[model samples]
Target: MARILLRSGKSPFDPVSPQQVIQQNLIATNTGNLLFGDAVHKMLLTPGTEITPNRYQVDPADADRINDEYDVFVVPLANAFRPSFKRHLNDLSALIERLRIPVVVFGVGGQAGTDYGTDHLAPIEQEVRRFCSAVLERSPSIGVRGEFTEKYLNGLGYSEVDVIGCPSMFMHGRELRVDKRAASLEDTAGLAVNVSYDSGNIPGSVIGNGLINRLADAALERYSDLVYVAQELKDMELLYWGDVSEAAGTSSPAPLTRSHPLLREDRTRLFHDSSTWIDALRERDFAFGTRIHGNVAALLAGTPAVVLCHDSRTLELCRYFDIPHRLVADLADETDLAGLPAQLYEEADFSAMVDGHGERFDRLVSFMDRHGLDHVHKPGGDDGAAFESELETVDLHPGMSSWKGGHDGGLGYRLAWLREADTRSRVRQSASDKRVRELTSRVGSLERQIEESAVLAKELAKANKRLEQLVKEVRSSPYRRLRRFAGRLVRRVRSRS
Candidate 1:
């Protein structure tokens, strides 16, 4: 069996975060980790392949161990080619340099605003080159997200690039069906909305933060049953830990603050896993947002989605997949928000999108095949079906909430709250112990370095002493005195002449 390693943002087996286990439950429910990591794992797993998940931020020292363990290293990166991602990309390049096995990249892309301009990416051109070069040395080609990324690489003189979109789109292979269940969105309909403060507005751009803010505010007002989904750690912190007095003065995103309608009205949510997120979206009427994955989650849930693309990262994927989207630049010019959702669907061709999925799926398969990967969707294969079954057996994460008790209220809530207190105490203690272990390990490494430095210092001291002794001997030697006397005699003879 071939051993494959997956590099991603999160792992399926990561410790249950405080966000995931907000209340005591029979089992800690966390599906957030599965959003990208496990979904890719399922897609890549074949009958003869064994897979392991590792976080993107790898310790350089572990490279040798990884080289010995895995046959191929695969990275599934979403919007990883941005300026913010340069450092991590460089780190991945360093990690790639240490690997002896083949490295295959999946759906990596560059970022600019929805205009697809390359100006913002200029600073990282050399960085991208280094990363691509390292991967090319280990594999035949690098898989890019879409046309913009492919062009981005071509401009850098890298021709061995394939446009495979994203693996997440193939969670169910070519059987994807994203339909607008309701012909029109209504005020009473259940709406799933996602927003972000960071990417919504770029400095010097007229169409960023304000557009998303207006859309969010309009949606909240129009729909009575609405849920706002947040994806980033800061947003998670704001949602769960924002009530503290210290939090008031801290830098929480304005839209996520206690004064914001989403959190203030008890309509905000953060999921620990993809399954739960997708499941939640599956029950909603429509999803629209600045978040690519958030809208993707909605599509995967069989709901219609409208992606508000402020940048190339979201724009490229939405375009490639035929998902409906409006450039934030264009949306900023619109005055009426009441009919935007319906208008977006009317402009989008869902049938065409679904029709072309097979070809795209084949393209993804071809990219995998070129790198010698065995996917679950091969001819006469039940690998894909088997993966779905395996995912079902995985435990679910708890729902999102800050309360000690589960979402349920009353005496049952009190009992759950007591249990939650105990769990939290234990969780804190475990975290403390883990920190101590990490510190001890670091200290041990430092001690060894110090010992090595000490030995080198002693050796340098001995060498210096030997040099001093040699100088002293030369100064006292008979040859040295004779030469000095001869020089003086020559000088006196010259002066007499």
Candidate 2:
């Protein structure tokens, strides 16, 4: 059996607690990452192929082990060409430089504003080049998220790039069916809403004028059964611990504060695993949000969703997949904000996305074939039956809800919270002690430096005094005066001659 190493925090079947997921950041900072990772993992489970999650490790020292143990290294990424991910890109590049196995990247994208400009990406241009160059050397081509990333890489003088949307959309193989169950959104029973808090904070952003948050607020007020699906680590922290302390000082009208209805009413939830996330969304009538994966999770659950494209990353992916979306910039100018959800639900067209999925899946499989990687969707592979059967046997955790929510205030829940809180407090104290020790060591080094400087100053002072005494002695010598007077006499004789 061929061994495939995947870049993921953990296997999808591995059930981790909310506290450990938060503490270790097993989702790699955003639970959204697991969506694509899990999709790729399921896709690559062909016969005679065994896959293992790498736990997000990119250590160059482990290159030899990987080379000997694994036949291929597959990476599924999201907006990795941004400035914030440059260091990680460089680290991955360094590790890839030493690997002898094939390396393939799936649905990697470049993040920019809604204008799709690459001027802001100049800072990490070299890092991007190095990462792409390393991957291409080991593989036939690199799969990009959409048109913008394809253009960005082509502009950088690379031709070995393909637009494959995202692996998450192809999780169910070639067929994706999304039908509007309710005749209208208002007639729907439940609504799932997701938001990107930072979307409202970015300067010059199309969605920066509180447009995304306002839409979320409208949905919250209009639908009594609305559930806020959060994807960020901080949101998970808030849902698990009910600690709105991070939102304490923020005065922004956006959901940055606990005063928001979601937190106050315990209407927010964060999923530790993607299966549970999709399973929970299965009960919702429709999902709409700025978070791409959040809506993708809804679609995976066979529920219709519309992506609110706030930037180039979301816009490009939605366009590639033919996923229904609306530009937040355009929505900001509309006067009727309350009726926007109904309009979006009515306008969304899922036909093209569903119709073109087979071709896209074929393209993705072709890309994998060119790189010598096998997938479960290929001929003679069982179409992920084994992966599906394995998933069915694992008992995954449910979505994390607020501590104050219904049935969550029970004694068992409170005990778990207390234990987790105590563990967190101990971690904080340990961190504090570590910081104090560091400061004490720094202070000791500074004192030693000061003492050395003082000793050096005294030595210099003694040397200066000795030099002054020697100079005074030389001036006071009579033989020295006679030599000077003779020299003056010789000069007067020469002038006369």
Candidate 3:
């Protein structure tokens, strides 16, 4: 058996949130981290293979252990090539260079706005080069998300690059089908929407944040069952912790927050795992979101999805996979909220997208095979039947909700973990101190005994030395030699008799 190590952002064993999730909110609250990680893990699922828990963050300190523990390392990244992530890319590059085993990258892409410009990554060109070169050294070619990344890497003088889209999209492998139960938007339609309000760099883009919030507002008001999906930790924080006042801040678009009327009314939910996220979307009539993974989750669930592309990172993937999407700016001219979701659903056809998936899936498998990875879905085999069967047997984790109003599953979650850790530390410290005092008393007693023993040993040595001198003096006497000679002569006469 071979172990395929998954290098991801968060460990799959991340503590189940202590917060009790409303049963209705369970599917909506799954974090994208879990969603992405789960997809990659399941994608590589094969007989006689093992996958390690995510080794979060690339630290040079863990390189040796990683190489020794796993045979192959697979990285499924999203928009990893950006100035903001340059430092991380450098660190990962250094770590990759240290890895003696093969490293396969899937869906790694450069980030920019909708312009698809490469200028943003200029500062991190060397970092990207080093990272790509390191992966190419271990694998046949670097699998990229789309043409933009292909061009980006080619410009950097990397020839071994293939546009493999994203592994997350192929969570179910080749076969994908989404049915529109409703021809038009109905009040009873199960609508799922996601927004990416956490793109801090483009903080001021009205279309990026404001338009999605507007669409969400309209959908929530008109639809009976609408789920607003948030893909960032901050959005999750606001959903669970931020009070109405903080959510009402000018900086916050309340429509996407817990303060939203629908969210407050218990029509909103958050998801922490992909299984629930995908299952939740499976029940939805339509899912449209600014978050690429948000829509990708819908696609994986076989639900029709529309991506509100605000940047190049999303644009390229949508284009590559033919995922139905519209620019966020287009929503500005739209007036009717009730029909907008239906309109987008009708206009966006996923047949070509779904039809082309088989080839793309094969491309992914070929890439994996070239890197010596045996995937569950063989090229000409029964698509993803084996993968799905294996997935069904997985005892998946349940999604978590916020404990209260502050845990964003990042700092707040970590803070809660830290508090628990501190408490444990105090308890351990108390026990350790008690043990230390007991050991100290025993050591003192041992030291005292050693001192006493040393004195006795010294006295015994002096006595022995005197006894040795006395024996030497007695032996030196001529009388002692005459007695010994007489004893020997008597013994010889006795033996002769």
Sort by TM-score, top down from the best: 2, 1, 3
Model 1, which residues run further than 4 Å from truth?
9-15, 19-34, 200-207, 244-253, 402-497
Residues 336-359 of candidate 3 have per-residue lDDT tens digits of: 866788889879888889888888
Clashing pairs in 2: none
Total colliding residue pairs, candidate 2: 0
lDDT of 2 by residue, 400-486 (tens): 877664565465445545756886899999999999999999999999999999999999999999999999899879988998899
Instruction: List lDDT for all candidates, in order.
Output: 0.75, 0.85, 0.73
Best-matching candidate per TM-score: 2
- TM-score winner, 1 or 3: 1
Q: In model 3, which runs have C-alpha deviations exceeding 4 angstroms?
A: 9-15, 18-30, 202-209, 239-251, 255-257, 379-497
Error of 2 at 243 (Å): 1.9
Clash totals for all candidate models: 10, 0, 11
Superposed on all Cα atoms, model 2 deviates from the true structure by an RMSD in Å of: 5.5
Q: Write the per-residue lDDT of candidate 1 for residues 1-497, one digit (tens) a residue.
A: 98988875444444466444344220212222345566678777778887876744466678999999999998877677778777878888889989899999988888776667787778888889999999999999999889999998999999999999877777777788987676777788888877756663333344435667777777788789988887666455445554432223432334645556677677888776677778888999888877788888888888888888877877899889888787777776678776676577566667867889999989988887888887777787674787767667777664464332245545434544454466579999999999999999999999999999999999999999999999999988999999999999999999999
